[model samples]
Target: MSDVAGTLPSTRPSFLRLPYLRWGLVAIIQLFLIAIPLADRFDVQRNGQVVPLELVPVDPRDLLRGDYVIINLAINSLSKDLSEGDKIAVGDKIFVGLQAGAGKAAQPVVVSVERDNAGDLAMSGTVRSLTENEIRVDYGIDAFFLPEGEGRIIERLDTSRVLLEIAVTEDGRSLPLTLLVDGKAFQSDAAF
Candidate 1:
């Protein structure tokens, strides 16, 4: 306590000079090792990540490319048998499971071909709803216009959801006939 050469009174700021229960266990281990992977790479701009689906098609042209809702999700479709140059493009992230035997109408297939770290694999079955897709299955309006930007800004049209009319079955198989909304069939237990 007698060394005031350069007026050194520095007693805080070297990792908070530690020792307060080891700086609260180093701040909860730096919040799960560096703020949880930087909050999991911005987690798709977060806004309540929902994942319910069952709207095979009914968006004739939800205002086309602007009102957007061109989806495909039999639990998250991926039935590529391949033929038209074995498609899977549009930022491929192919890996949806179920098809080996598809016993109970099995659905949800696309077991592995990885590509979308976030590209969205043909809009990875867009989401943002929590109920009614026959009974829960989502990712609506493409994750609510992906962090909110396009999809015609959604223009507030989540009616009650059930707007499907999917089809990509040239072999990339994502075909789901229809399920209408402003046209009828409010839900007769239609699984596709």
Candidate 2:
């Protein structure tokens, strides 16, 4: 091919002219994006602490998404004494203090806007709403995602007898690790 000056055609854009440089740049970008989620998962799986929470039932479907159990945790509403110091309002970051319950169960003992090392276990959450005697918190571990048709089984489960395995960080944020029914891992059961 020839140009208007009877010269050969140019190669490619100057920025991407070097194959190795172009590929390296793309690889770096991909690694950066992928690392964020991987790090979060690793943090929970490795150093995060585990806390067993009682599960409460709610609708099992979302119109926009599909097949996920809405987690209505038993600890969502707690007593005002758990608020620690002064009264907390909506949108405040709080920690749900827990204590060991009967056999692998964790009970919410208190809720405090500040971190207290005295609590046996603490999971971070945001205050959704509060009242004189009660506080509603959102722990962000509010959904249990499952494969297609699997959520139906969870929805039908008696939540009063179900327990959710949550991994909580020292700072109080938590992630749902598993679902257990009657002290047995739900995944191992054929009925599930």
Candidate 2, residues 72-173, lDDT tens digits: the string is 888888888765675688998877788966666787877776787327579888898877889888888778766667778877877776888877777776
How displaced is residue 164 in candidate 1, in Å?
Answer: 11
The sequence of per-residue lDDT tens digits that candidate 1 reaches over residues 96-186 is 4333221122345333343232122222332222221111223233321112243332334553455443332211223333334554433
lDDT of every model, 2 decimals: 0.36, 0.76
lDDT of 1 at 8: 83
Candidate 2, after superposition: displacement of residue 53 in Å?
0.4
- Give the 10-residue window scoring lowest on summed lDDT in candidate 1: 127-136
**Model 1: residue 191 alpha-carbon error in angstroms:** 29
- Residue pairs whose backbone atoms clash in candidate 2: 82-111, 124-172
